[model samples]
Target: MTQELGPLAREVAMSYYEDALPAHDRFHAKRVRDVSIRLANECDEPVDRDVLSAAAWLHDIGRPLERTNEIDDHDEWGAREAAALLEAEGVTSDRIEAVACCIRTHSIRSSSPEPETLEAKLLFDADKLDAVGARGLVRLACIVGERSGRTGERHAVIDDTSVFGTIASDQPDISLLRKWARERLDRLYTSPGRRLGESRWEFMEDFFAQFDAEIGVDGKR
Candidate 1:
């Protein structure tokens, strides 16, 4: 996405996106980059614009290849793969490694509880914030679209067994994702994220509430 990443790296990055990306990889990554910039400003630490920005963009490079496409155990592949891609594009060794480390450790299981540097903290905060609300839900819809997913009867909650079953599903439930997102909302780390994501989450909550009202609980009618 930059002239600095050079011709080869830029070409590779283009190739990566031309082929389809998992929902989070496509939309959420961009969203994270946007938020990471804002977070970088508020924090006391100094974020490496090149490192953090590149990492943010490439963080999900391995996602399309993963069997589950779940966040679990995903960071390493993305990190290693991203490092190779970046290296080919002429990114500096230290910067490349730093970006790769952030990518590799972004998963809940893989991530350190603490951000080791400004880039790490900014990336970490941004990625987590991506899961919080309206944007996150829209990103999920895009993922479903990649699978050509069509819900049964116009609004059925599709799961892993469904034609476009979510990768998270050894069996995935659309409702389950909504529930999990609600839980993760409480996981936002940075101050800006806490404030920024709240309204987004509240909007989503209201949308679902109206949806339930329309669906008619228990179909009692």
Candidate 2:
């Protein structure tokens, strides 16, 4: 099943993500799909790899629309879009719903629906995994830089001497983003996900520690 649907899904995802933000581009979808399959192999229970693959590939298809304010919620909009796409591809209704469910809840947003199926949980975990480690920080920095109209100057957001001068003076967005990434370490639903997330979270901690030390925030300079 995946052998057939996977390529089509990738083709569709690439079209939507071609002009997406750096943080949520086609590469991000590929990473999530790869990680979802990798984690699925380690699970003790059976997993619907086809559903996971389709969901992972299509999960962020609506992000470009959301970025342009064409849609209010990417997760919700992506779910509906995935359903229609898969249905047109002649996928069964049950499988389409499973894919839709995974897309609907893959985000970390509080308002997003909770993932109930094993495939949904794995998709959520894989998506969050990409938002944590070294890669995660890079993605976050991209978002911050883009938002501040300082694209390509990530140091201003992640390693700025001014921003790190004092804990109280840290930019609110970066602070909230850091807190959000750290909290994902605990929100993982699977043991494998937790193990991987902890390692990534530790890297993030070390990075901030070095960042602070270099900026004299720790009084070491």
Candidate 3:
């Protein structure tokens, strides 16, 4: 029997994401987990609460502790740290391994690392999904807010600061962006996702249109 490891997931997630040294924190992990859970449900995939939850929660463990200062690439670092943490938590060796697999491949743009299991794919999709919708919009803003110049570091970090911050500030310097959060909300690879994501996407489009015309991007009114 597989371990559900429900509360354990939350506890582990908190331990890493909530950093005191300006490191990325649990909120980001939770958002990743949120996307993973949603994808799992939508895909009718077996959600290994232990693996999925742990991976999702631990996905960004290395973010706040970045050493390189790049803040744009850190998926591998997160995987390494997450493995250590899960092993410490006494997760079964097998489950621990599976969790590691998912964590390792969570980042999609890492040279197209292939996900072997459904869990990995779900986590990957969820992480990216969060970056494309309204929620993604908020994350983009945060990314922009955190962008700093390069630095020496140990843990891998992300560089979403520019794109992310631009979204939040509403001044990304790029005009005529027809494919924004609202615009992306309508696109889902799965049917269930479309059901939940479509309405939200529509709402975002409407909200964005309010500012779009005012900005003269669409040249309306």
Candidate 4:
């Protein structure tokens, strides 16, 4: 699998690195791939490794286009783009279709059909998992920075000019978002996904609690 895809997927992923946001770029795809593979190994049902691997790498390839409004739906565009890329890579037609399906429905926000196959579910789980952990906090920070016109390196520390710093200063609002994150943890599909999410979810909860206390908004507000 490494010989066949390790390089190609990395190359394909690099195409998005320069254009996409730091949080959702090639590195995000790699995290999803790692989590997806782990879930696939722990799944109760059988999952096709090739399809999952390809889909994980290609799933967010269309994010740049979506952000630019070149496509209204990243998932749809990603599915089509992934299919074409897989075909060009000499992957089997059936595998290409399966990979496309995984990309099409991996998004929890999109109107695309829910993940039906084992591979799709695992990919979905892996992808969403990144949005809830400590990684999730950092990703949220990047998003906040982007919205506030303060975009910079992925791992920048929080500051007044940064989004996370703004969030830290705003207690009541951040509390609401923390509530939303807590609820979202229940939405994980696969058992392994949920199992993995538990710790990340708790970590977020604890972080926010500490955040509230440190910021002097622990109980009153």
Best by lDDT: 2
Candidate 4 lDDT over 128-178, as tens digits, reads: 788787988777666656555534323233422334434344323454445
Write candidate 2's Cα lDDT for 124-214 as tens digits.
9999888898999888777666667644333344444354356554345345557868777678898778888898888988887776577
The number of clashing residue pairs in each candidate reads 1, 0, 18, 0
Q: Judged by TM-score relative to the true structure, which candidate is superior, 1 or 2?
A: 2
Rank by TM-score (best first): 2, 4, 1, 3
Give TM-scores for every candidate, taking all chains together and pairing residue i with residue i.
0.71, 0.86, 0.68, 0.81
Off by over 4 Å in 3: 1-4, 20-24, 67-73, 148-199, 215-221
RMSD of each: 6.6, 3.8, 7.5, 5.6
Give the Cα lDDT of each candidate.
0.64, 0.82, 0.60, 0.75
- Number of clashes found in candidate 4: 0
Worst 10 residues of 4 by lDDT: 153-162
lDDT of 3 by residue, 35-150 (tens): 67776776655567557877887777766656445454467777766667767777778887788788777664537467778787677666656655466556654554454333
TM-score, candidate 3, is 0.68
Of candidates 4 and 2, the better by lDDT: 2
Ranking by lDDT: 2, 4, 1, 3
Clashes of 2: 0
